[model samples]
Target: MSTDTQHGESSLLIQLQHGLKREQFERALHDIRAGWNRRELWMTLGLHDVRQRYRRSKLGPFWITLSMAIMVLALGLLYGQIFGQDLHDYLPFLAAGFVIWGLIASLVNDGCQSFILAEGMIRQLNAPLSIYAYRGLWSILIAFAHNIWVFLGVALWFGVDLNWNLLWVPVALLVLLLNGLWMALFLGLVSARFRDVPLIVGSVVQVLFFITPVIWKPEMLPGRALWLDLNPFYHLVEIMRAPLLGQAPALANWLPVIAITVVGWAVALFFYSAYRWRVAYWV
Candidate 1:
């Protein structure tokens, strides 16, 4: 094309880039609403992500199950012996704790990359940022499903009681997913702008893995149980793990988790509203 023609085209593109748009809240709302309306898109993308990751592997996603099974058995036996707890009790507890921890940790770690990983698509398409967040959470949930088989097998082998309280499993999962949404939005936004945020998030999650009750029982904390009570992950894990182990989680567990979910969403919503417009540039 001629120089003038190319210059005019570039000017038009710049105008479109800076064109009139909705206010921040409306834009954020539209991003979410439009994303929800296109659930199939993100769900397919998410599942495809899982499938693609394991595409050439002989065991595919079953590798997740196998690795988790090995980790649970190894850790359960070692920790049970060290803590002098009954194998029957500790194995099932470890199984439940590992499964829940995997879900929480994966969501937080991967959620940080939701937008940055989708940079190409975000730049090329006029889609909602929430779509990328959904894809991240859905992909993690798919992997969680794969890892959960180890827990089910452990429960069955140990003959853990299948009480009606197990219904809380899905409830707890729903709460986790809700929390995942806001976390994905908030973390994804921050990580897109600050490349260091993902590194920081991964490091924090790694530290939390040891501190959280994944391999160790909270009873080890003794009179310091109040510290565990303050940990949101402890409650999240207990709500799911207690039910799976045929026990009811204390009311304190449910209350703090619910409170965190509420407050987290509010903060995420405000931050998202303020920063959603800048994501494209940041990414």
Candidate 2:
């Protein structure tokens, strides 16, 4: 607390801030790298979010599992009849698609609120902005883990053939998780600045659920298979759902998905680097 010591500490703080201000890209990189280095902190925050959400409920996160199971069964039965597919074959496909879609849709929708939801922490703490994004995505991963149990149960009940192709599922899920990271960073920044972004995201996700082939199959659209080719969400779902249902995804699916991943990250990084410093103010 001596005068010279206090002066030195103040000078150090100014130097650090000035260094960060020197280059926006470097500042953004530092934030992302620092957030990764502080995995323990973000992981703890992610777990805390899950706990807070299920605090007083007896079933806790299983409630999500139950709800997902009900949706799959109800849709599988209704849509199976509509699409003229056997229930046994249709249920497994529907279950896997719905489970994967739930994760993808939730990540995109929730990414919109990642920063805004953590407004108080951003204002009062010195953590990197990307830390909130990481935490939000981690929470989504945890929820996905819970919801996937429904798929397992459906698979068991239907006796779907298991093949070595199932091994690719983890890789596909990892790719989706990578997409989730950039999405959280990009959408979080935009949503913090524009309050309407989350609402728009929600509406889009709702519409996509019907059109993205979750309840129906591509075979249902035989003449215009191009529709599935153009839908990025379909590509995402196909990469995992096809493998889970014991079929290999086409090369076409992987090509567009990888391209989108690269382009999406490029766009996310540019805006995140440029506007990251403004997040606290916006939120």
The TM-scores, one per candidate, come to 0.90, 0.90
Model 2 gets an lDDT of: 0.87
Model 1, C-alpha of 14: deviation from truth (Å): 20
Q: Can you write out model 2's per-residue Cα lDDT over 1-283, one digit (the tens) per residue?
A: 6355556646534543543454888888889999898889989989889989898999988888999999988888888888789988999999999899989997899899889989999999998888898998888989899989999898989899878899989999999988998999999988997899899999999999989988888877858677678999999999999889989777888998999899999999878877787787788
Residues 69-92, candidate 1, lDDT per residue (tens digit)?
Answer: 999999888889999999888898
lDDT of 1: 0.88
| Regions of candidate 1 where Cα sits further than 4 Å from its true position | 1-22
Clashing pairs in 2: none
